[model samples]
Structures are given as C-alpha cells and as structure tokens.
Target: MPETNLPASKTSFVKGFDKWNIAVASGFYNQKIDYMIEEKKQELDEKNRKYIYKMLTFSLLIAFILFAISLYVSTYLEKYFLKYRKKIYKEVEKNKKKDILLAHQSKMVAMGEMMENIAHQWRQPLSIITTCASGMQLNKQLGLLT
Candidate 1:
C-alpha cells in the first residue's frame, strides 16, 4: 500500500456509514422475517378451518345414514309384527270354533243320557197302573163291584 494522508474525521465517517448500512440491512431482514411468520400463521389457520369443516360434513353424513337405517328397521319391524298379529288372531278364532263344537257335542251326549234315565223310571209306574185298571174291569164284569 502507498502511504496516503487520510484524516481522522474521514475515517470516523466511514465507520459510521458502515454501522448505518448494517442497521438498515438488519431492519429489512427483520421485517421480512415478520412477514413470513404472519403468512405462515394465516396458512395454518386456513388449514385448520378447512379441516374442521370437512369433519363436520363427515359427521353430518354419518348421522343421516344412521337415521335412514333406523327408519327402515322400524318399518320392517312394524310390518313383521302386524303380519304375525293377524296370523295369531286367525289361529285364535279357529280354536274358539273348535271349543264351541266340543261343548255342543258334550251337551248332546248328556241330554241323550238323561232321556234314557227318564224312560227307565217311567216303565215300572206304567206297568203297575195297567195291572190295577185291568183288575177293576174284571171285578165289574163279574158283579163283585157292588
């Protein structure tokens, strides 16, 4: 290097300029970093919102499907119960008719037995009355009724 006569004030001014340049560059980088951080935060918030919306949609779809299936099952059960009820009613009616027929047959048999007993009771009384009347007629014909 050649020997040059540089003033102390000029050297101090150069040092101040370097410090000012470094400060300006650091401020610019700091501002850029802050902007990047804000953008990243906004992106994360948007993603979270979308995720929540998708979850809500999926849940609603599942609920609707469950509701539909329950309705179908209820309808099927109602129909099945109704069909069985009708069949049971028909069977009950048939059993009632059979019971009535059996009761009528029992009554007829009891009446027949009662008639036979009545005929047996009257037979002896009728035979005694006929014998007494015949004796009275024979006595009157022989003139012994005076």
Candidate 2:
C-alpha cells in the first residue's frame, strides 16, 4: 500500500519489535481513519463558512456608514457653495450700481464742459455786433446818414 493510504494506528510500536507482528497486534483499521478524516474536514468547513458570513456582514455595515458620510458631506458643501454664490452676486450688483453712478457723474461733467465751450464760442461774435450797433447810433445822432 502507498504511504498516503496507510491506516493511522492508536497503538505505539515497541522498540525492536517486528513490524508485521505489531501490525497484527495493534488491530488498527483503514476504515476508522478514513471516517475520522472525513469528520474533521466537515468541522473545518463549517468554521470557515461562519467566518465568511461574519466578514460579509461587517463589510456591509462599513459600506453603509461610508455612504451616509458621503451624503452628509455633499449636502454641506452644496449649501456652502450656494451661500458663497449669493454673496458674490450681491457684491457684483453693488459694483454695478457704483459703476452707473460714476457714469452719470462723468456725463454731467462732460455736459458742463460743453456748455462752457459754447459760451466761449459766442462771446467774440456778440461783442462785434454790439460795437457795430453803437457806431450806427452815433452816426445817426451826427446826421451823417441822410
């Protein structure tokens, strides 16, 4: 028989004993060893199944916790972003109003400069007309315009 198929013996061998004599005296059987091996394999399989179930349950619980945390963080960030965006919008509106006010002031300044330029342009012509009218009045008084 091959070494792997040899039966396990409960009895220990005596020193200097003949191997064939011990085999007969020990009364060990192959069928009993095979039965014990099969029972041990089933016991180990059961233990492995219980360990796998525990690991699966623990993994699912951790996954659920992580999912909840992600949801909370995403919601918090969304609200914060909205608040920041509103603040920025208000700032932009305020700057737009300031720009409009500055544009109006600039237009008023330009209009005042235009009115000054128009008055300067008319001054010389009005002075010339006044001098000619005064000379005509003086000539009429002297009777030089028959």
Of the candidates shown, which would achieve the greatest TM-score relative to the real structure?
2
lDDT of each: 0.81, 0.84
By summed lDDT, which 10 consecutive residues of candidate 2 come out lowest?
20-29
lDDT of candidate 2 over 82-119, digit per residue (tens): 99999999999999999999999999999999998999
Q: Model 2, which residues run further than 4 Å from truth?
A: 1-28, 127-146
TM-scores for every predicted model: 0.58, 0.66
The digit string of per-residue lDDT tens for model 1 on 13-131 reads: 22235655553222224444576999999999999999999999999999999999999999999999999999999999999999999999999999999998998789778878888
Q: Candidate 1: list runs displaced more than 4 Å.
A: 1-38, 127-146
